[model samples]
Target: MEELIKRVEELEKNTQKSSRERELLLNRICELEDLVEDLTLQLKKSKKTIRTPVAPKESLAINNASKKTNAQEDEPWLFYCPKNKPYEEILRNLDFSEGYEITSSALVSEEALWTQILEKMNEEEIPKKLTALRKLVSVQLSSACHHELLIIVRGIPGNENPLFQLILPHIATLAEYVNIAWSEVENSNPELLGRIALVLECEQDLKVLSVDRGDTRLSLYVEKLL
Candidate 1:
């Protein structure tokens, strides 16, 4: 009988030990699962951080090149026309009937001048087109007036002085972009002259050339780009 009792006690102790070991194994398994979850989260976060920088770096490189190219383009020679009365409307109504005969030696036909101006205006860039247009006008005016062809500005003064000098490398840089100039535009639209006046009034950097500041406010000239 004592042997049987001893056997029963030993069996109970073994069962208790087995139970404890099973509980410990379960706790360890739980700990391992938690560790796996934490590792997975960390990996996802690391992947996100790694991917963030590459895209911006390429974008920055491209932007720098574009900016550099833009910086190299030519700037316009701004000239201030001094006149008590704004000649914006008058300039628009100029009849090229007399033709460009400002010089005694030669005469330039209006059709020839118009053809040249139109060719120059046929540019992809709006600023280049405008610059070309301004140049053409300057050429015609210089020829018509019998003066050394210089930069020209014909516009009415605005009510308020310009606060900031806007240097538009392209017409795209302007507040408004108008792809409205061509041979037809010059022929029918007298407002074309007013368009230039509008640009002068709106943008800055039209540098006034050192020309004769006379009573006649018909045109303004500069010896060279200041």
Candidate 2:
């Protein structure tokens, strides 16, 4: 009976030890699976971070070049018309109208004279010639006597009076066709339409007018209105 009892106790001890070992192995397997899942999640996040896009250096360079080109194209000139000279002399002596011809000049053409006048208005220094240029534009508009005038106005850098207020009433009058020749203009060339629109917009008035771009014969009439 004593021997049988001792044998039964030994068997129970052996069974308990095996169960403990199995439990330890199962815990270790669970820990390893958790580590693998964490590692996979970290790898996926790293790949996503790496895949994010960055702007190319060449694209940045191209954008900068485009801005520079636009700046150069919009560069403004200075006005230099004097009151003491003949209309032809004022047109000729001014640096802005150096090569421009008055006889063949259209009312609204982008000739040297017109460019000079616009440059003067756009200059940073606000030269004394601005007054003369303004008068010139006003006189030209008055002489052409077109009912509907379109003016394109662009502000000059560093200018306090950048708005096209100086030519507003005249432009407005032209738009209404109150004093100018509306019939002849309607029958004339259409190419002057764009220039006329620009002039009208430049004035910055809240008025609307129609211009035809197809007529080339009215260019002379448009020039006179300029």
Question: Against the true structure, whose lDDT is highest?
Answer: 2
- Could you tell me how far off, in angstroms, the CA of residue 89 lies in candidate 1 after the best superposition? 99
lDDT of 1: 0.31
Model 2 poorest ten-residue lDDT run: 60-69
Tens-place lDDT digits, model 1, residues 1-226: 9999999999999987975675465556556766898999998888745444442221111111111111243222222334322344324333112211111011133333333333333422121233333444444432322211121222323335331212221211111111122212334542333222112322223333111213322222211211
Provide the RMSD of all predictions against the true structure, rounded to 1 decimal.
Answer: 34.4, 35.7
> 93-178 in candidate 2: lDDT tens per residue?
32222222221112233233344443433432222332333434444444332322323332211213433333333333333331
Clashing pairs in 1: 78-206, 78-207, 79-207, 80-208
Instruction: Name the runs in model 2 displaced over 4 angstroms.
Output: 49-226
